[model samples]
Target: MMEADILIENCSEIHTLKGPDRPRRGDEMQDTSKIKNGALAVKGESILAVGSDKEIKRDVEAEKIIDASGKTVIPGFVDPHTHLIYSGSREDELAMKIQGKTYMEILEEGGGILRTVRATRKASKQRLLEESKARMDRMLAHGTTTAEAKSGYGLDKKNEIKCLEVIDELDKSHDLDLIPTYLGAHSLPPEFERSEDYIDYCIEDVLPEIADKDLAEYCDVFCEKGVFDVEESRRLLKKAKQFGLKARVHADEIENIGCSKMAAELDAISAEHLVKTDEEDIIMMAESGTIGILLPGTPFMLMEEKYAPARQMIENGMAIALATDLNPNCWTESMQMVITLACLQMKMTPSEALTAATFNSARALDRPDIGSLEKGKKADFLVLDIPNIDHLPYRFGVNLVEKVYKRGEKV
Candidate 1:
């Protein structure tokens, strides 16, 4: 018998999400590559074998075996966009939003992102690390093995580096794999006279330090109206590229001002929050191989009526991904809830939502090894109490993840 580290046998169902190595698009997104009575053998951190129960039992032996007889198995969720390393909650803003104050109006009154920045700046690294660690635990409990965490609340050079340092520490300390992103351009800092000046400071001061320390894999900008415009965003992203960091953008969330088009032009890995993206830009993004990362939970939490045009984007051959946008503003670490919001509010199918949350989300982060449950991929998966995949988004408002595994070890 071929020995392995762990064997999960007699699974009721497995949504392998095994298909092309690239992200799914158009008709391809419907294919979930499901297997019945499946079994998986893991060796160290990578999948050794995946097949029917009888086939795996005949082919392999394991040091430890798990009988998932009545459980469903799937690749661990990948959250490509999040601001999870922050100081405090924004519940006060929630009350204002509930009372019919618009997002921009609140921002003008200094009660949105800036409020969180104030708290985060005042917080010590140890406190930030503890809070971020707690959030990472919540993400793990929700079945997310890999998540992208951004540093933006620390808008200045010192505090921005401090936030990224905390994120790096959390990455080393937590079980969840945290992908760090430098989002110093998340907003115009209060000290800056103009948004351009803030963008210049990030490029001139922060980007060099981030590159020197190798703190982040990606550099992101909030390319929205009353924020960094498309031209300024391009300049910052271009400078970040020179430092060997990939580009990602918060594109077209509040207004359709061609941020999606700009993302395509920059060949960014992903464009997020395309709530107002036009059809031309949609086609452009699809053609440019840029993934569209949609955060339905943001709109849901804001009580906004217009969700992203996910159906249209999928129909137009765009590779779509879903994330919680987990922040003090959205306040959710549950990708399961994001799936539900994608289906019920964004009108995505269960299969599409699952694919978006898993495979496509990994692709958004440019991670090829962690999204699927194939033979060569990392053995990060979830055992669910449900019978089938549809039950996850169907039975919302509850945690269905029975257990989580990372690198072949149960966490």
Candidate 2:
């Protein structure tokens, strides 16, 4: 018999989400690769075997065993986009939006990203770490074991470095695996007069320092109409590549400005908030294999009727992922809530939403280690209180995650 470190047996259902090495697209997203009466063994941090209860019990011996009877197990959610390291709340801005103000209108009035930038810049590293740790704890409780966190709230060189450093510290100390991204081009700081000059400063002064410190794995830019245009975004992302950082973009949230095409041209790992992306750009993104990261929460919070064309993206053979877009503005950390919004607002099926949040989100981060419950993958999964996976989205506004495990250990 093979000796194992841990074993979970008699799970009512297991959505392994296992399939081709690439991200799932079109009809493939609906197929969850489920196992009935499932059981799995973990050896150290990796999954040893996954099969029927009888199959695993007969072949494996473990020091620890968890009887997951009547519970469903699935891969822990991978949230591909979040701005969880910021300081303070935007409830005041929320109130402003309620009184008939647009996001850009508020930004122009000095009350959007810059508002949080001011607070985050003034925050000490310990203060930032503490706040971020609390947010991550909430995310973990909701079954997010891994997430991609960007440092865009700090628009300048000093505070940007500080933000990334805090993210690194959090990653080392917390069980939640936090992937850091440098988003110095999130918006123009008060110091820079022109957007082009700000981009120049990021490429020349900020990015090299981040790269030297190995502070971030990815470099992201906000590629909207008023933020950074297509050409400016392209230049920043190209320079990011030169620093050995993977590129991601916040594109086409409010307008179709050819940013998605820029993402395809630059081969960005993913393009986020495609609520206003054009069909032509969507096709280019699909063909170039750039993952579409849809944030339904953004529109939901902003009170916008239009959401990302997620159903169309799926129909067009695009690999789609879902995220919370968890910032002070959006103010959410629950993947379950995001999944619910994806189903109700974006018209994705329950299975498709789960797949997007788990397997496809992992693909967005270029992480092959934690997306699925399969041999050679990290044993990070959620044991839900429900009997089946669909209940997660069906029973919206509830926390269904009974327990979370990271690398074969309960957390």
Candidate 3:
């Protein structure tokens, strides 16, 4: 009964992925099925209908039609964890790491995240916004419709809010939906001599002001060995929840600090970077419905030995997601590059990698409204230049995205 504003016709294959259980049975958790010779009709900002070409054509009249004769149609990739607002690149640190300086050693020498924090604090908000906008343009070109950008590079409250405000302004101006997360608990600023005092200030001072202004939807903390411990992260996230923010944690990236278990117990939306997370934490996360977010690019870039237990998580029936971890520290804003790294290094199938990047990643953000192409869902999808979907990961290290559309309009 709904008339369509646009229709994409004669797609080589349309990947609807319109189901609750993903990693579709019998394929590796990364493989997805397709509907051959498909068509999708959209009205306003939602999918009006989808089916074989004949069926969709019969149901609605389209005001605009796009002939995607040789392309593959897929739901737009959703990236939920990223630190896109920073001042400069870490190429010098990358060079040092390649020269055999360890990540922790670099951090100790004040050359890692702290270095970026200093640079970001000095940069103007307009400059940060300019750099972040460029990165987001690249992400959109690579077929990402929705993404979460964190503000961890700004360790202090003023710079942190400035970074979040950049994200807020981007959402109003850009086509992509940018979700902002406040991460004052990311690290101890130079002014704070004691880590405990830093945690207290983040929880008591900054978080309340952020919540009052409705600046962020989520509050995150780094619950690693040198960062806020599991106990500190717990108290901080617990207090943030009282102020109406959902919880997220940077857990076990460098060591087993019990972040995954705490996130599971608290029913946090997700726990990211579980390279060193224990088997007990794995079981707990699976049982509690907390999504496990993996950052393959971080391990690949850092050449770390510990990889998130992807196969183990899939086998245990835990929902798993993949992210670029797009920060100044490790990863870049290339989601396709992350897909290739996830498939090759983490031993995930191409299909499973796609699912992890799309549907499951949306779940990690505690969102069900986006990520999949179903009737009545948001009309966000990518039209790939490739004919086959399997080529996404198989033919890696190349850009195959031909066109991207969101909200029933070509962006």
Candidate 4:
């Protein structure tokens, strides 16, 4: 018999997210690939096996066994696009937002990404790590085991490098597996007159430094109306690609500006915040097989009436994922919260949202190991208090995670 460290039996259901090990699209997103009366075995940091409760109990001898009773088990969430290394809060912007001031209007009034940028620039590396660790703690408590953390709040070379360094520290020390992204071109620094000049500075100075130091796995830019336009985004992403970093784009959060199309042409791994992306943008992205990471929390927090055309994207055969967009403006630690917004605002069903939150989000990060609970995959998963999948999204605004297990150990 196979020996195992732990065996969890009699789960009401288990969504293994069985996959061909790639992002799911169209009707594929609707398949949870679940097992009824399921059970799973964990041996060290990997899943040894998963099957019917009878099958697991018959085939394996485990040191510990837990009866999950009526709970639902699924892979821990993988948040692919989050500004996770910044220091500071933007609670003051709440009043401005409620006053009918737009996100761009708040920025023009010196409040938004740039506002956090200034604070992040001044924070010590230790302080950043401490603050970020707290956030990671909350993320883990809410069932996120792996996440992509971007260093965009520090817009300059030095401060940007500092933020990446802190991300590195947290990756090693914290339970969360952080994939670092250098988003130096997130905004135009005040020192430069033109956005083009700031982009040049980033490509010339910041890009090379980040690449040489091997600080980040991907490069991201805010590609929108008021930020880096298509051409500017193209220049930096191309250079970052040359420097061995993969591409991710914050495109069409407010306006299209052809950013999603540009991202598809460059074969960006994912284009995020597509609230304004139209059919052409959707078609091109689908053709390129670029994943659209829908951050529903963004529009929800921005108080905008429009959200990403998630149903259209899914219907058009584009792979869609969901994330918290965890930043100063939309400060949320729970992927559960993100899933709720995705289902309610973007019109994705709970099953599709769960798949987007787990497997598709992992594929977006290009990590194949953690999303599904397949045999030999990392044992990062959650045991939720809910009995079935519907309860996950149906019960919102509260933590549904009853237990979180990362790499086979409960946290």
Those runs of model 1 whose alpha carbons end farther than 4 Å from true positions after fitting are: none
Error of 3 at 46 (Å): 1.1
* Candidate-wise lDDT, in order: 0.93, 0.93, 0.85, 0.93
Q: By TM-score, how accurate is candidate 1?
A: 0.98
lDDT of 1 by residue, 219-239 (tens): 999999888999999999999
- Sliding window of 10 residues with minimal summed lDDT for model 4: 95-104
Worst 10 residues of 1 by lDDT: 103-112
- Cα lDDT tens digits, model 2, 296-359, are 9999998989999998899889999999999998988899999999999999999999999999
Q: Model 2 lDDT vs. the true structure?
A: 0.93
Clashing pairs in 3: 29-352, 30-351, 30-352, 30-353, 31-351, 31-352
TM-score of each: 0.98, 0.98, 0.95, 0.98
Clashes of each: 0, 0, 6, 0
Model with the higher TM-score, candidate 3 or 4: 4
Model 4: residues >4 Å from true position, as ranges?
none
Show where candidate 2 strays beyond 4 Å.
none
Q: Candidate 3, which segments miss by more than 4 Å at Cα?
A: 21-33
Query: Model 4, 148-183: lDDT tens per residue?
Result: 999988888889999999999899998889999998
Q: Model 3, range 4-72, lDDT digits (tens) per residue?
A: 899999999888777755323224354455688999999889988888988888887888999999899
